[model samples]
Target: MMSYQQLLDQRAQLEADIAAARAAERRAAIAQIRRLMSEHHIASHEILPRRAARRARLLEGEVLYQDPVSGATWAGRGRPPRWLAGRERELYRVNLESQDSREGR
Candidate 1:
């Protein structure tokens, strides 16, 4: 039996209460996370692994092409290097057979 205006006011107050509760809970969570990080001596990098580190690990010793003249290597990812530009990429491909033989494969 509440009036329309009374119900609208109640709704507004409920929304404000919800927002305040969310803010309080977020602050508490952040505080707990900080405490745990401090106690464990955890660095931010350890928690959030770097994409560059993973990329380097994956590309390690994985040269797909080589510039015979300069001996520069590429893993055939991203943009082609200056020496490899405007040329057939297959010409610069590393000799996989030679490489496999050298590795005793």
Candidate 2:
């Protein structure tokens, strides 16, 4: 029995209510986490594992080799891609100009 405009307004109001509820829930969850951290005297750094720190450092640097056919690139740091097996890495070496161009030089 509601008019079209009334139904639209109701929908908008419901959306706003849902957003407010979600924000309140997030704030409550964050407060609970803070309380738990304080109770255990846990530092923020202690909450983060050491593997993440290592990964953050390792992700830097540039691609050293590439597969010309598949366009797959490797930074030449960790294990070489299987496609590179039995092939000369020098043949797949990426030039500085190509690397710079790809990075929006």
Candidate 3:
């Protein structure tokens, strides 16, 4: 038998608690990430592959590419036009040796 004002206040308090909990969780995660980086001898600002921004993303049959500056995920569905530059070919081969070794051909 809560009044309307009491219900609104309860909702507001719950929302604030959720936000505080989220912030605390974020801090904990970042601390763990920092500890792992130190243990692995990785730089603090090391960049990893970006994640997709869509609601339900999958990589099984999707093409992989990154926007160097903004790290936006994009597909490579269509054939490249003749005007595409040749130098871009080398940009996609950053970890060439790992890829070749994986095939073990």
Give me the runs in candidate 1 sitting further than 4 Å from their true place: 52-105
Q: Please tell me which model should have the higher lDDT, number 1 or number 2.
A: 1
Looking at model 3, residue 97 earns an lDDT score of: 52
Lowest lDDT 10-residue stretch of candidate 3: 53-62
Which of the predicted structures, 2 or 3, would earn the higher lDDT when compared with the native? 2
Q: Give the best candidate by lDDT.
A: 1
Error of 3 at 51 (Å): 12
Ranking by TM-score: 2, 1, 3
Ranked by lDDT, the better of candidates 1 and 3 is: 1
Residue-level lDDT of model 3, residues 41-105, one tens digit each, is 99733544334322123333232454455554334446643333354844532343563466562
**Which regions of candidate 2 fall more than 4 Å away from where they truly are?**
53-105
Candidate 3: C-alpha RMSD to true structure equals 11.9
Candidate 2 residues 23-100, lDDT tens each? 999999999999999999998889877887656544866677889999998888878899998999999998967767
TM-score of every prediction relative to native: 0.48, 0.49, 0.44
Residue 8 of model 1 has an lDDT of 100
